[model samples]
Target: MRAARFRPGACLVLALVAVLAGGTQQASAETSPNLAIDAPPSAVVMTAPLDPSPGTLLTFSVAVTPGTNPTSTGLYVNCDLSWLGLGPSAPLFDDGTNGDPTAGDLTFTVQATIPSGTKPGTRLGDCGVFDAESRSASTSYSVNVVPAATDVGPSVTDTVPLSDATDVATDANVTITFSEAVDATGSWYALSCASSGDHTASVTGGPQSYLLDPGTDFAAGELCTVTVTA
Candidate 1:
């Protein structure tokens, strides 16, 4: 069958995919307050460091609203993020502990580790916000885990216009390859010739390789030197 073009029906699916890729998902259950004994949470909140890496800590919290359950007090919270190796049904607290900001505010919070060796990805899951009794409310949550940044400094692996060369092209651009990805912020290069004096070049390109495009060419038969600082 031929592929379908942009249709209204595809919008919902695309939007859902976009959310799953880089957004949070949440849903709340509807229950008649007067008929229930346990208060259901109106919202669940999960927080972590920006682009958290494996082994980082994550916090989960839920806000409970009073229902017709007049006797409900001392609310409890538990979350299942076992996909991250944290035990299922891990407890959260509202007693101004375990990262909770206030006690008896109906907002319970807890922290859990992402665990070492956890691959980077967006993980979707849920938590249970319960009253003092057996009744509980469910809320879905997600975490976006990113790969850890490498700590090893970059080293030059190779370069164009090889170390020392005879009769070289004056307008040639210098290219360099690095052992690892590099940050080019505040990077610069200087090219000078024995006969032509100091020269200037625009440093460009990226994490693994860079190119140096000189504004002026080297003088013929002149010894040239290049300096790079990144």
Candidate 2:
């Protein structure tokens, strides 16, 4: 057998070998930001104050940590308000311009309101926290709806024909809507006229809705005013 010799050309390739004394595979990076709902012992923590008044704002946060910056982030607060079917949605906010909230810190806010009728004492409210990454967290918070120092005084909320109404039809029955309920004793319409023109309420309409037929038909051009005594 004859020994052959290799010649190096202009494009000759050389094999490169790397040897490690301790031969260990490299560790994967962990800078991917994580979505943290809140601080804890309790992940679901209350952001509202103790004995919060009805209509008080309750707030919480969706935080990111050890997060790779240059990321787009956002959050939302979801609550079912019987008074208002759905809460509002939020939009994303990016901090990449400043290279901030980039690696170890950043948070977004989610806020809700305690309904006016949220009874006095502790009430449980579950508000959802959603982040830009499509991750979600929920916090069950205890809110103390402060006792209404004063009675929930009844007030007119809406009316059928509208207020300061002009050119109203003579046959039109006045419909008044109240914020809360009232009995016949507390519910009455006092007409500007001293004479009781038949101010009768219709119970069938709804507890909050009262239809009043001003005793009799209006004298044309008579400026009539009706006030609800609740």
Candidate 3:
């Protein structure tokens, strides 16, 4: 009791220690809950319209869910239409988090242009999505390419002047009009030049006009001949 009468400093030290202990307890009680993701680990779903038409644009939708809502996440989808062996394969599309949890579904769309002259059969390929962090939970879908009506024909309507004076451009391009859409793979089209040069060509068009690009250009004032085989 005699020591306490002169122990103001000791009392002050005890009060500070009690205040710090109370603050630490309150901070621990206010902590946030842990984040979580609940998507299927190895599942995916995709859908498209029935009886899709050739050369017509089609939309494909894909859905993906992640096993855990990662602090950092992204979605990627790759499609191969080469089974159709059309032109080039379809490009990949990305579907990131749409301000939603990582465990929810994401949708993606693409336009399908049936090859200019695709055969009547089923086109097959695969589609898949993966997370940057947890790739083990990736999902994939089998893509099917269905046959559509074929009404393309071969008929040349007109030709326009080309602008290759030097005639050195290997890929000189020109325009050709058509009476109707022609089958690009059909045996009714031929592109040639009169100069007897080592030149190759490809034809690309829709319902109205075809763009032709020669692997090599013709001599000055030399005429290039294009034949359509339908």
Winner by TM-score:
1
**All candidates' lDDT scores?**
0.75, 0.52, 0.56
Which should have the higher TM-score, number 1 or number 2? 1
Q: What is the alpha-carbon RMSD of candidate 3 to the true structure?
A: 16.8
Q: Tens digit of lDDT per residue, candidate 1, span 1-230?
A: 99878878799989889887654433223332445554443456657566788877776677766444555555676777688666788787889998888988888788777778889998877877666545567778887889977777667888888878777898888888889887765645667889888877788888789898888888888888877676
Residue-wise C-alpha lDDT for candidate 3, range 156-205, written one tens digit per residue: 66765433334444345767776776545554456666666445567677
Candidates 1 and 3 compared: the better one by lDDT is: 1
Model 2, span 1-230: residue lDDT tens: 99987766522433222223223323223444567554211123434456767777655444433212323345444443332223334321234222223333344344557677766776555545554665565555455567656656878999867877778776567787888876645456665533435344434465778777654666565566777764
How far residue 67's Cα lies from its native spot in candidate 2, in Å, is: 47
- Candidates sorted by TM-score, descending order? 1, 3, 2
Could you tell me the lDDT of residue 188 within candidate 1? 56
| Counted clashes in each candidate structure | 0, 3, 7
lDDT, model 1: 0.75
Point out the higher-scoring one by lDDT: 2 or 3.
3
